[model samples]
Target chain A: MIRHIVLFTWTDDATDEQKATVTAELRKLPDAIPELRSYTVGPDAGINQGNHAYGVVADFDSADDYLVYRDHPLHQAVIAEHIKPILAARAAVQIEV
Target chain B: MIRHIVLFTWTDDATDEQKATVTAELRKLPDAIPELRSYTVGPDAGINQGNHAYGVVADFDSADDYLVYRDHPLHQAVIAEHIKPILAARAAVQIEV
Candidate 1:
């Protein structure tokens, strides 16, 4: 399996409503993309300082499956319309499991 | 459960051996720390451009359990001895799963 994890740090000016929209839109992805074997998205738990504001962890059977999710229209739209507007810094990694 | 994900970008001078050491050392943490419910660590799969070099995803039953793994001496040693020396950038998030 391949695990794709992304961390996002919102811009200082980003509003909470915008952040919530990102989460809501992300929560709809598993249903919209069949290749997703597992998915989890949420705000940071605030257990530590200096942590990114949000995270997404998605699993797929193979790299090819991950690519489908990566380029899916719904996924791209969420990134373009919701995430990009508030994004400050982003880091992502996809790893074999 | 609480899922803790951390992304890392290695310093330009970091060698393959150093990165390998970091992976090998991190693989030992689940056995060393009892609170970890699940853990995955690996270099990026290279399916995307401009992604972080590596990622770690760890799951714990609760926030307090995560704290135990977070502060574990063995885990800290791996960071101090292997990762910190070659660390370039890091982003982490702990979220409810």
Candidate 2:
């Protein structure tokens, strides 16, 4: 199995309702991309005095599938229209188990 | 709870034996740090078309505990002796859940 983990930090000004929309949009990706076997999205809602904008953990069958998912146009749309503008910085890790 | 996620890429030349030793040492961190709630470490061992060095996901009780883990002497020793010298780049995300 292959896992692609992305950790992102957004601007502090971003609001809760906006993040909820983003989360819903992101969760809908698996249906659009055949290569994306599984998708899990989470938020760090200041419950423990820490705040992370979002975390996306995805599971795929192979790296090629992951690559296809990465290059998909729908993914691009999400990044361009939603993520890129609000995110401060993002870190991604792609590895096989 | 707070989640402290650190993603690191080590130099390509670093050996498996070195990585194993590092993994063992990293796994032992929870024992030394009282606040650490959970620890998970994984490798991107080149199974798929792409390769990643390693991935670490940790769970903590609070941001203060996470901060202490960050500053802990044993953790610092591991970084200085094992991680820092061999790492190309490292990314970390700490947030509440």
Candidate 3:
């Protein structure tokens, strides 16, 4: 399986509502894209300092399934409409497991 | 549970042997630190362009358990002796799951 992990830090101007919206939109992705084996998305737990504000972890059977999720229109729409405007920094990696 | 996700980009001079050592050291953490519920570490699958070079995903029963893993001497030694020397960029987040 391939595990795709993404960490995000929001811009200073990003509001709670915007962050919540991003999470809400992301939560709908698993249902919209069937290739997802497992998906988790949420804001940071605030346990440590200097951590990114949010994270997304998604699992798929193969790289091709990951590409399907990456290029899916619904996923792209979420990034464009909800995530991009507030995104300050993003770090992502896809690792084989 | 708390899922801790960390992404790493290595310095240009880091060798394949160094990376392998880092992975070997990290894979020992779950056994060393009993607090870890689950752990995954590996180099990037290279499926996407511009993604980070390496990634770690670790799960714990709670934030406290995560802190124990974070502060454990064995885990710190792996970072200090192996990862820090080659790390160029790092991004991390801990999210409730």
Candidate 4:
């Protein structure tokens, strides 16, 4: 499986309500991308002593599957409309397992 | 290979110079921990429309090796002195590949 992991940190100016909306929108990605085998998005536990705002994990059958998910229309929409607009800082990496 | 990815976003109050110092400290991790096969840390490109300050990725021989790297004293020191104290938000995940 190939797992794509993304983490976001919103600034203090970015309200809790804003993160909630982005979380809701991101959660809809699995339904939009067939190659995605599993998906999750949630807030950090607040115990890690970091500014982490949220976490996202998605798994695919292979690297190619993950590539497709990366370019899928829904994913693009989220990047452009939601993530691109709201994210204060983000990081992502994909691992093959 | 097992990959451990960690991303952090510093608050606006965090100076670029501060990130540079943390980046330097974090980059020293691989040599300190024998289990860390490879590691990378750097500033986020400003165009991504997010608050992300830096990124860290390290590959391990296996999950057990990753666990060892996780608990290593060098990593703990970096976390306590640099990461934990400076991070506004952070996220991490491990993938077996």
lDDT of 1 by residue, B1-97 (tens): 9999999999999999999999999999988898988999999989999999999999999999998988899999999999999999999999998
- lDDT string, candidate 2, B1-97, tens digits: 7766667778879887777777888988989998888776777645444334777777777778887888899999988888877888676666555
Predicted complex 1: DockQ: 0.94
**Candidate 3 at residue B42, lDDT?**
99
Minimum summed lDDT over a 10-residue window in model 4 chain A is located at A44-53
Question: What's the TM-score of candidate 4 when only chain A is evaluated?
Answer: 0.88
TM-score of candidate 2 to 2 decimals? 0.66
Stretches of candidate 3 exceeding 4 Å from the true structure = none
Residue pairs in collision within model 1: none
- Over A1-92, each residue of candidate 4 has an lDDT whose tens digit, in order, gives 66566877666676677777787887788777888897766775443354356667677888778778878888888778766666776676
Error of 4 at A75 (Å): 6.2
Q: Of the true interface contacts, what fraction does each candidate have?
A: 0.94, 0.31, 0.97, 0.08
Residue A88, model 4, lDDT: 79
lDDT of 1 by residue, A37-65 (tens): 99999999898999999999999999999
B6-81 in candidate 4: lDDT tens per residue? 7776776776676777878877877778788877566654422443566666778887887788788888887887
The alpha-carbon deviation from the true structure for residue A5 of candidate 2, after best TM-score superposition, in angstroms, is 1.5
Q: What DockQ results do all the predictions give, each relative to the true complex?
A: 0.94, 0.28, 0.94, 0.10
TM-score for all models, in order of appearance:
0.98, 0.66, 0.98, 0.54
Model 1 lDDT, residue B41, Cα: 97
The local distance difference test score of each candidate is: 0.95, 0.75, 0.95, 0.70
What is the lDDT, from 0 to 100, of the residue B84 in candidate 3?
97
